[model samples]
Target: MLSETNKKILSLAVPAAFSNLFDMIQVIVDMIMLGRVSPVAIAAAGISMQFLGLLYAFMASFSVGNSAVVSRFVGAKELDEASKTTFTSSVIAFLISIPFTIFGVFFSKYVFIFMGSSEEVVKAGETYLSIISLTFPVIFIEFALYSSLNASGDTKTPLKIVVVANVINTVLAYTLIFGKFGFPALGIKGAAIATAISYYISFVLYLYVFLTKKSIVSFYPLFVKDYAKRVLGIGIPAGVERVITYFSFLLFVKMIAEYGTYTLAGYQVGLRIEGLAFMPGFGFTIAAMTLVGQSIGAKNYEEAQKLGWQTAKIASVFMGFMGVLMFLFPQYFAMIFTNDEKVIQEAILYLKVVGLTQVPLAIGFVLSGALRGAGSTKLTLLINTASLWFFRIIPAYVLSKMFGNVLYIYYAMFVETFLKAGILYYMFKKGYWKRQVKWKT
Candidate 1:
């Protein structure tokens, strides 16, 4: 029998998990469709998506900060403050996206080339990257809205919105990618356009919900300097952390690229399939963050600790089970994305190696989210930077150079996940986040 607390956490987690899964499905659809075009197409889209992920890493800082602040206010019964935070966060996200949009549009070709992609892959990816760049502002806006809603304990609304958005995306992608229903075949460009369109649809829906005052948090036109500072104070460290993390990932991708296009495509496919494990981890992370933030806001430190551990425990079970499935059916999952025998073989290796680490990954995600919720972004930043660079990146680079084998890179990844998870669990037990000062609403 589940306790009430566990029920509340799962009430949020189930919907959020499905939402994240659907979000990944959008990309999986793209990969599957593009795989039919060519392995080069899959590789190109994968690299371009990584760059896009880098851009979203910046936006995630604001989204994360908004979630913490808004949830804290909600817990404290400061509805007005929560609403104001949502608006201000959205504004900041939009403003920050402008320069990134310009940079992405102008330099996407160079970025793909710099990743060591072949000429065909680079050309295939450039248009896709450029089109998606145009939607950067809306993407951030949607993030703000989702964060605000999730913080207010309304994960189901975002789940509904994402469902409709993905439906739109899938239809557009199918029609435009293959010239179905008399639409012109735009290849990779069609996938980009579909994604951008879906983003806009979600953003519009979010904006309407906020404006109509139907959401848990309403939009208000109050922008206090102190409030902005509070959000950014927590956010900037997160932003820096993500920027460094994604930059490191870019470097990792570059190293992977040296292995060849088929290898890169396989890695990308394995990564997407691996999202099955992450979906639950991410959902539980959100639950942990929200519940932890609310508990802290209400000055119930014990409850916060309990919620964090409980969420991690739940996430670990589900993710561990998923890992077992991944290990068992690695080849089957690989075949869903690509028919290339070499690519499927490589993806199978990645899936099998990474599958063993899902429980550790769950621990890391939940604990990190707990820390973030308590406004301990600086600590997380430090942990992520040190663990990622020292444990993951440096070891990976050295092992790859020594062995010249992609399997060694995956081994490094697996080892680093466990190391970081242990450190995060230890830090959570030490209770540093409880001592952190709370923002005044």
Candidate 2:
């Protein structure tokens, strides 16, 4: 028998999970379509996508902060404060995306080159990077809107919108990438343009919802500097954490690239396939964050703790099942993304190694989300930075050098996830996060 709290968490988690799954599918569609062109194309798109992930990490800080603050307000029955938070977070997201968008368009080629990619790969990635960069502001806005809705316990709206957006993205990607339906084949660049167009569509949908006041949190014209400070105070640490985390992952990718283009492509495909397992964790993280924020806002610290644990338990079960599938049928999942034998082999290896760590990964994901919701962003920052560098990055570099095999790299990731999961559990149990939240009313 499931508790009512567990049921409510799933009500939010399941839809959010499906929505994230669709987002992953959108990216997979791009990879699958591009994989037919060449492994180099796959590798190029993968590298560019990683850079985009880095940018999104920075943008996610605002969204995460918005969710925490807005959910708390809603919990306290303060709809006005929630609305103000929504508008301010959206503006901040837009403002922060501008410089990154400009740099991505103008100088992204140097980034690929510096990552040690071949000239051909760098050339293939440049246009893709430039086109996608143009959509950063739209992406930021859409993210903020989604965060606000999720905070207000309206996960279904974002889920519905994402489903529609991904359908459009898939159709556009296919038509443009293959020059289908009387369109000229644009290859990787076409895929980028399709993604950019889809983002604009999503932005419009989000704007419509806001303007119509269909969301629980409505937008207003006023800007409060103190509210901005409060949001950013929580967001900056979260953003810095993501920036460092992604930067480290970029270095990790650079190391993988040294193995060969086929290996990098294989790793990329493996990751996309692994999203099947990880998306559930991400979904539960959202649920945990929102529920915890609301609970804390209501001044029910015990309930917030319980919500975090329940979310983690459910996420672990789901992720563990995914791990079983990954372990049993790694090749099947790997093959869906690429036809190359070498790429498939590398991807299979990655799936098998990382699959074993899925449960612990789920724990890390949920607990971290709960802490963030409780406004313990700085704690997460410290733990993630220390553990990531010490347990994953430094060890990965050392092991890769000593063994000169990609297998050691995957092992390092497995070890890091387990250790970090334990550390997060300890922190959650210590209950320091309860003190972090302060009611504004």
Runs of candidate 1 with Cα error greater than 4 angstroms are 35-44, 116-124, 255-266, 338-345, 402-406
* Cα lDDT tens digits for candidate 2, 416-437: 9999999999999999887677
Give all TM-scores, in the order shown: 0.92, 0.91
Model 1 clashing residue pairs (backbone) = none
lDDT of 1 at 305: 95
In candidate 2, which residue pairs clash? none
